[model samples]
Target chain A: MNAALPILALFTLLALALGLYARRGHDMGLEGWAVGGRGFGPILVFLLLAGEIYTTFTFLGASGFSYGSGAPAYYIIAYGALAYVLGYFLLPAVWRVGQANKLVSQPDFFVHQYDSPALGVLVAIVDILALIPYLVLQLTGLGIIVSLASYGAIDKAVAIWIGAVIVTLYIVASGVRGSAWTAVVKDIMILAIVVFLGLYLPYHLYGGIGAMFAKINTAKPGFLVFPASGQSIWWFATTVLLTSLGFFMWPHSLGACFTARSANVFRKNAIALPIYQLILLFVYFVGFAAVLSVPGLKGAATNLALFKIVIAQFPPWFVGLVGAVGILTALVPGSLIAMTAATLTARNLYGLARPDAKDDEIVNVAKAFVPVIMLIAVYFTLSGSSTIVSLLLVGYSFVTQLFPALVASFFPQIGVTKQGAFAGIAAGVLMSAWLTFTGQSVGKLMPFLPQAIKDFNVGIIALALNVIIMVAVSAVTARKALQPARS
Target chain B: MRPVYWIALIPFVGILAGPVLHNHVHPFILGMPFPLGWVSVWLVITAVLMAVLYALDPANAGE
Candidate 1:
């Protein structure tokens, strides 16, 4: 009976309506459904690409990170800026290849470039493994936002179930177009709300942004700067480097790149998107404010810092507005992730298994798999206790395994054979799983190493092993002509 | 690679310079901690450099 619950329900229904409406006038062929018919102009393409940035992860996870870990969260801002620099060059090349080959999914690019359905299947599996955790992060954020905004009237599990169903409904109906249409609304609402809270909170709590940071610095020394070890400078630098290399390696990001009208859209976006990414600084401001105000949000609960602070200060109607934007942030990315995962399953996994299946039939199979993927994500959301940022880093480690082979594909001189790409990805993914499961960092894995070297992001070690295996394997395997080595 | 593309590396180097050059809380830039401010400044520079690169590149010229 909370006013916020009614508002949340209303906006959720609006998201559903917008998503289904997006499917109108467009043929729901595999290409149209998955990549929006490859006709998105600059604005729509910008929303789609930028939409990937300001997700539930950025909405809650980032503020939560700043609240929990302090200065290490600034790596989020650094990695994204550097990633856009890489994307300026990387995405346009991806677009050219995608446009020329009519590639429908990220795995399709690998299949065409390597001429190996087997490698495509392998990539599909890796992408789905990585994507499920990301999807879980969105659902987890949705659950937290809804429950908090409703003043704990709604149960977390119930909120997540409702969110998953709503997302699956639109995604099954409209595919990427559902996400793109909702993204327009999500981006605007997030921008205004984040900036307002970011500026207002610090002033309201501690007079100003500088004053707020000054107070936190005095209270918790070294909280706003990197330490010499552990989550230290070396960790930040290496993490930023590794994640930038892996940024567009996300299947959904590559899928977004392919949705564009031309390669130039990426070139133009490379200019605009970095500026947009700085908005995370505002998000961080809100998080930093919460560290002192909403103290004791530890472990998995840190992701609630932003919303908790907002709920404490704002009335029910305003909290409802924030909750509505929170749901949009999740739904936009959640739908995109679900749609991409389902398409990958259909196009790369099942289609490879059944090579004679028609494109329309594969599209139907993808739609059917939306709910299946959502169910898997929901189960993980209910069970997992990791912080939202940690969940994403796990996904990043898995997908970044793809970065070496992907970059090598753009240049034939690198001569990464399909066999090499396959072996390297397998090795890297296995190493990531080992590291993640064992709860090991490079520091613990190799105790004798210097603090600087030891503190390197654990993913970089897997990447190094991947590159060595790739180069070693390619050295022996016969090189095939690299298709679309136009760059 | 075009020499113009080297402009892209400036942001990477600048932002990653956090641990080395700008990891401080004082002398705040635009009311942010030095590291955060440094990276925020580089974000805008990155956009400008990409804009410059976009203009210089002949690949985008015809379009």
Candidate 2:
């Protein structure tokens, strides 16, 4: 009878209702739609940020990585905790600047800070480029979740189409508030489901958590800890460092920060969100439990670790519940990413072209972009474009290029000029793209380097190039500014 | 930045140093792998550290 399909459908409808309900008492202007009028308090801000940070990636990607690679997955947990440590200081400053300047999009910060609309345009392009793959990844996960949970009764493409339409509907109606409302349901459901599955699976299968690890250690030696080479300690450490910096650089996360009313809300969130991040630990538990109980899930199939075990052990009704929660995981973050990309397009990209465009016109344009972006994501999802899927791997590194310019903006002493910022970012993005497309790792790029250095995440190399280029160009341009004024 | 704010470095140090400090699989803390338990412990430490920072910092004092 496929009870999971009905459960999934009902939850999707409920999320849409909550999203629409969120718009009842609020204005839906450009300011209201983009940043929720900059009036979200501590709890809403926390859940909204959590909603963006913990996406379908956390549910499938985190668990799947643990099932496949073992200890390297611990970097996922480490990076989030450290990123919030950064958010403790970083987000409050962003919120303060955002409030003062009426900033709505992430690129607006760069535009104002550097006093360069051109830089804003560049940022907007990079953001949307980075976001497309991210959005497609979420939709792809949604299809996989729905089809797998439904016992193969539903088609993946139909599930993706339905998910995309629902996200667009809510986001156009309520914008960031829609994502926030859905997040409230999502956070509660995920916490309950993940904790239950994480505990029940290990104890039910292997007598206890400790026993599971002991058996896994005996079965797959050295899988429980970092190896001396390949994805070693160095890789874990550097990857954690790269991802933490890149976390807030995501346009959606930065945009989420602007939704808060007070700077202190971020400060308070920083204290609690790391605790929230501990949820990933249980996710890892679920992945580890699957390694022994439900084996042979290789490559991409590894992502089904959570669902496969659940369906094998539990009834259809419980599987439906898990599927319902999985749908929220995709929809909440998908709505936020779509909204961020649309606002970036309408305001920074289109608004720059038509400077005379009114605020009402810009908001309408943003709303118009919501479905367009969703359709593009849907097309890419169904087409199975290898180009974009490969781009998804470098999405983090591509956006991390902005970190040097972003942090430099906060400190005027560095004197990073607009030209320098532009050149550094362009070069960094190009470097990462070339490396990714060519399938070049640090080891492959420079065979003479030590294995430890070779094992470092290639993103660090891109970021280093970004910083070096930024500093050199800034130095040259800064001196040029100080010297005689000759055109 | 104030001197007290330096306390935030403790989590970064504790967690990133896992490769060198707690890379072994044995001696699982709370029934998890050594590295997994290591990160779990640091997550708690980070939360506690932030709470302390929130209390001691003057910027958050009024709010």
Candidate 3:
């Protein structure tokens, strides 16, 4: 009677075996554990990057957005396609810098560029803080996926523990290489499940997508597109801009940049990634179909729209398999997030703190952080309030604050001083967090400003201020340097 | 003297141009909603644009 135990356990074992096999015969060192020895070709790089970016957020959340809200879901497609374009231009240069510096982690780039080990430590701390929430999101979603698919045959806490233990063990044993290989499996299964559901659900329920939309649009006019005055056109535009900018700034993505054998690998993936995102369009279709067939989903229940439709429409075994795929979606990205957080602590923080720490020692130290990171995430998962989740969610934009400093690092003539970077980052994070918190607390930050710009994400507004501070500080420092000094 | 990087900005702007194009839901294309089609069109164009930008790069020219 129970579908979750057999299906999830089998695939989890298979995935664990595959993950373990991925790192076999590879030497463990800073390079291996952090960047997969920087030897992956274009194809592996594509799968790893794609798998990393398309997590449970893409699988469950996007469709739910479509089911619950309608047209704003298109931002998922808009931001992703846009992000790869940004990535295409920005990442190759990053790869070049990383290669030149022999950088294994994101903070390594920060250290080498800003010429400040202290900055590296700051980056490591900020990166881990930013990542734990994302990891917690994945682990929490995995728990729900396992229990839901099993039809409550397994307890949600049990599912969460199972996912946490497996993810921790495999990531520690295999590192980034293990993460990439498991990604290959996750990607194949996800694409299959998503595509099948996207095509079959619409036709089976509503005869076709055209007919399905005809009913939804008839019932609820303007549900298909964003409103102009309230959200305004700029609202959508700003979110796409802010989130896309935030995309590459993520430490896992930055670390993924160094895994490539060449910078060209990033360029090729940038082009290919959009085509991969077209899959989301199908996911949108699933969400819209859930609206018509499985109506009345509310709040947290909305996220269950896609999976509920699958369980209702498909056989129990297929439902179990879909559940397995969902778990993989969570685990694949969770492993990468955990791996990067560990890598940042080991390579950037520990290595900087103890500069004499050996290569193998750094690698070992990072491996040790693997379980610690997961356990901390699991602890937060168990204990964290909605307020805590909101706190971390606000931090998503704090990572984007690093964009100005990061861009300056690539160009020495930009004159971004170390103090300026520090001041700018602190201001950016503080302002961005303040804006997000106040908005959540008070409902809106500015009622006086024009509806168009005022409706936009606070992160971009904070980012604009961040850029000004960095430039102003840099100009002052630059001018001060040029001025003659008296003894 | 010109920056090819500036040219890449065109595609980025194009990607965000959808919601600002219109406020209503009546207009549809390719048997889908307007925003959906707008994003799909840009998604394809983004791929082509990145490919072109790659070709234009002197660093990648040796290939």
Candidate 4:
């Protein structure tokens, strides 16, 4: 082991101790394990929310994208802020409904509102399916950071497995409280390191942001402009819109919502989250700065961009701290994702499979599944061929199908029939899969639509088709229910 | 009557306008380098707008 390994080990041990300590008070029950017994105040909620939002992707992927694409990479920062603003209105409704119903998962809310177990199962399955890829993305990021920090001494697969095991233990032991409490420390360290480094790195490297951009512009004008020549305007708009829509739909965010002590906590989180995003703006700039500072480093393992920069510029000791921060970033979300997946499987699949299961038994089952899920995630992380963003987008596209059922449930009058919801979900899913695998636009596939409308994002177009089908089927089936109310 | 709608618009507009207008008009605050610049201004505006909207939307008045 290198000299830094001891420092990294010390940091990891401290985090684990804190996580275990936080688990002391809560009972080993489903509610306690999954939702922290529904008792998180604003501070904890804020930290948890912030932690969930800033993953390894934000650290590595944003910089890599910025490094690769240039200014348009700022959209990552832009969309995060937009997500919170959207949540300010959208989440309160969800918070109130969840509060009233004691909703545990996103599917629980959907099924509770619509009175449809089938829809709940569909949401759960889709959530787990979508979440696996995301979890793998986080794992892959963790592996990259570890591999970089260890200077190839630690194998990527071994690094991912080691990180996964540590996180899985904390989550299984402490659950959401474990994740939340650690998140408090994780967020502070991340914010401090990122802000300090974001400012220091640019001036140290290229004098200033303006100077950096100037060099980048001369070298690669496409990076500075919107919808650069290779990327079309439609693709940009659709990607941004889809990314914004799918941001809050992640099951982990919903899991965080249920842990909020009150609706006001959720609201405060929404209001304060953009401040967090402002910090993320610096993280995004680190990406652009990386391009100018570290040229010809492209195609050299995009996931290691941030670690590479830190190692090149900062000292070994400081690199250790940055490594700790990067590891913590992965740890917080990694634990939560494992917890969310476990909870999803336990509550949705196990519970659905065996309705008579006890609460304690369910909690135990969830705890047991944490490591299993992490192993699966580790397997995929090692096995997958694509980058983190590609995996995440595929997952996002899958989860977006749930939007119609979720939105429709808010209006009691709409009364989307279970059959209709499933039909829409099925059609949307098939369309998305076809579009994803075939690489041919629906227009090209059908040979009927204009070229402009042909090359659509599978997710956006599929989501649209889902909404249309759901509305049509609901209207036709519930036509009598849709009639004007008798006076 | 919900200011929340208007409040949401600040960031909404920023995300839409910041990139479009990024090439022109670099706004500064008190001669300091506002790294966020337009995004930060938009966030502050959005926060104020949201706060105002929350105050006006009686539903948000802690019923």
Span of 10 residues, lowest total lDDT, candidate 1 chain A: A478-487
Best by TM-score: 1
lDDT (10s digit) by residue, model 1, range A255-316: 99999988888888889999999889889999999989989988988999999999889899
Interface RMSD of each: 1.2, 1.1, 1.8, 4.2
**In model 1, which regions exceed 4 Å deviation?**
A479-487
Give every collision pair in model 1: none
Candidate 4 lDDT over A1-487, as tens digits, reads 5666776777788778878888896685888888888888889878877775688888887778767765445556666667776677677778778777777788787677666677778888888888898888888888787777767777888878888878888888899888888888888889899998888887889887667666666677455555422233334445667777778788988778888777777666766776667787677657767775666765536656677788889877788788888888888888888899899888888888899998888888888999999988988888876766667778778877877776676665776766677778878877877777676554556567654444444467798889889888887778543332111
Model 3 docking category = medium
lDDT of 1: 0.89
Estimate, for each residue in B1-63, the C-alpha lDDT of model 2 and write its tens digit.
898799889998988876557799978989988788888988999999999998998887763
| TM-score (chain B only), all candidates | 0.85, 0.88, 0.77, 0.58
> Which residue pairs show collisions in model 2?
none
| lDDT tens readout by residue for model 3, A1-487 | 7655688889999888988888789987788877888898998888877875568777777888889888877778888788888888788888888887788888878777777777788788778878988888787778778878888887778888888888888888888888888888898888888898888888888888777787889987878888755455676787788888888888998888898889889888888898888988888899999997889988766778888888788877888999999999989889999999988888887777788988899889988989899889899877653322243345577798888888877666678776677678778888877776566311166667777767676677778888899888877777554321101
| Alpha-carbon lDDT of model 4 | 0.73
Task: Let me know the TM-score candidate 2 reaches against the reference structure.
Answer: 0.97
DockQ for every model, please. 0.80, 0.82, 0.69, 0.31
Ranking 1 against 4 by DockQ, winner:
1
